[model samples]
Target: MATLGFIGSGNIGTNIARLAVAAGIDVVLSNSRGPETLAATVAELGERARAATPEEAARAGDWVVVSIPLAAYEQLPVAALAGKVVLDTINYYPYRDGRVEALDTGKSTTSELVQEHLAGAKLVKAFNNISDFHIPSLARPAGAADRTALPIAGDDPRASADAADLISRLGFDTVDAGPLTESWRFEPDTDPYAMPYSAEPDAMRAFWAAAGEAIRSGTAPQTPPHVDQGVPLTAARLRTLLADTPRKLTADRLVA
Candidate 1:
């Protein structure tokens, strides 16, 4: 069993950590606030989890999840995560993250910027599209008739596989949404980016198609996926909404 390190142990980080532990993975948790702040979470996760510094967590994991706010990407410990599988669960909201002209102008997606910072880390974009509140409760057994699917995008095949494997253990299916450059498809405005997984797959595809168009047209307004806390999505409802839209391969060059 590989060790999973989390760089931001907030709502999403802690939820995923709990799920990972339940799935039999060891987790090392960190945050901008330091190890002491995660005492309760560490206590809850028991022997399977340990709290550590961000750099320490980065160095300790076979797989690392970076769940910090997009604005703080520059703060990630690039050198410590080299050659590691890094799951990027970041989404940009101008109001919360302030303004980054490059991202706003479609010059670069947030993951790309993180990749640039941690050039040696194998980066995968996932978990960002789902709500923190629902992550822990939604995982089901692999191939369970009712398992929901989550979208993942990354530049590295092996790293993506590793991420998908981790996702599977958490009780959901994985959709390879292409390379990190196409991660914009799951950005703030896109249908799949934040929509409740409870929706049927067709509705999900339709929502993403509609949302993707909104992004291409420069009209996304930081709207999140519709969610009502505590309500779990049905498996059939999640599958019915899956679609087969053409995968996008965006220009590799980040906007200057």
Candidate 2:
């Protein structure tokens, strides 16, 4: 079984690790605080999971998940992650990450910045769009009638495909949203961000398209009301709501 290494074992990372463990995949978890701090999490994950330093986790994982804040991207072990398939689940929050001029100006997306730093690693953008609370609840078995779909963007086809496969193993299908540059479409404020989709593939695609239309037409809700509620969204219903709603980007909004 391939080991899934985590560079930051926070909420999303920990949840992913849980899913990986349940799927029979071994996991090596790490965080900035240190391996010692992850004792509880490691114990909870049982024999299949162990704690390690960031560099050790990076070097050990066949597929590494970099789930740290955008502000901490530079601190990642670049040399240790060389040639690894990396899944990036970072989102830029101005208040949390401080104001990044490039991100504020739309010059670069968070994942793009992460990709630049991890040049040797094949980076795929995913797990950022969904709420951490919904991850575990939303996952469903493959081909199940209600399996949710998540979007992924990456420059490398092989790497993206590998990410999609891993996501499937975690109980969600993947919708290819093109390369990293186009990843902004699914970023914090775009149509697909945090919007729950149906288990049916076509329904999921329609939800994405409708969300895109709402965003393009300046009609999507500025902040998703259903985020905390975990609304069960369908393509047709989401389309109507998105069209009727209106979005307003604040001055502090993270661009690109």
Q: After best superposition, candidate 2 residue 196: deviation in angstroms?
A: 3.2
TM-score of 1: 0.80
Q: RMSD for all candidates, in order, please.
A: 6.9, 8.1
The weakest ten consecutive residues by lDDT in model 2 span 247-256
1-256 per-residue lDDT for model 2 (tens digits): 7899999999899999999999989999999999999999999999999999999999999899989988899999999998989999998766557777777777877788899999898999988877676688778787787666777889999999999999899877777777887676666666666654323434444554565456556686243323342444433543443344333232244332
Each model's TM-score, in the order given?
0.80, 0.80
For 71-161, candidate 1 gives per-residue lDDT tens digits of 8999999899999999999887654566777786778888898899999999999888786766866677876765667788899999999
Among these predictions, the greatest lDDT belongs to 2
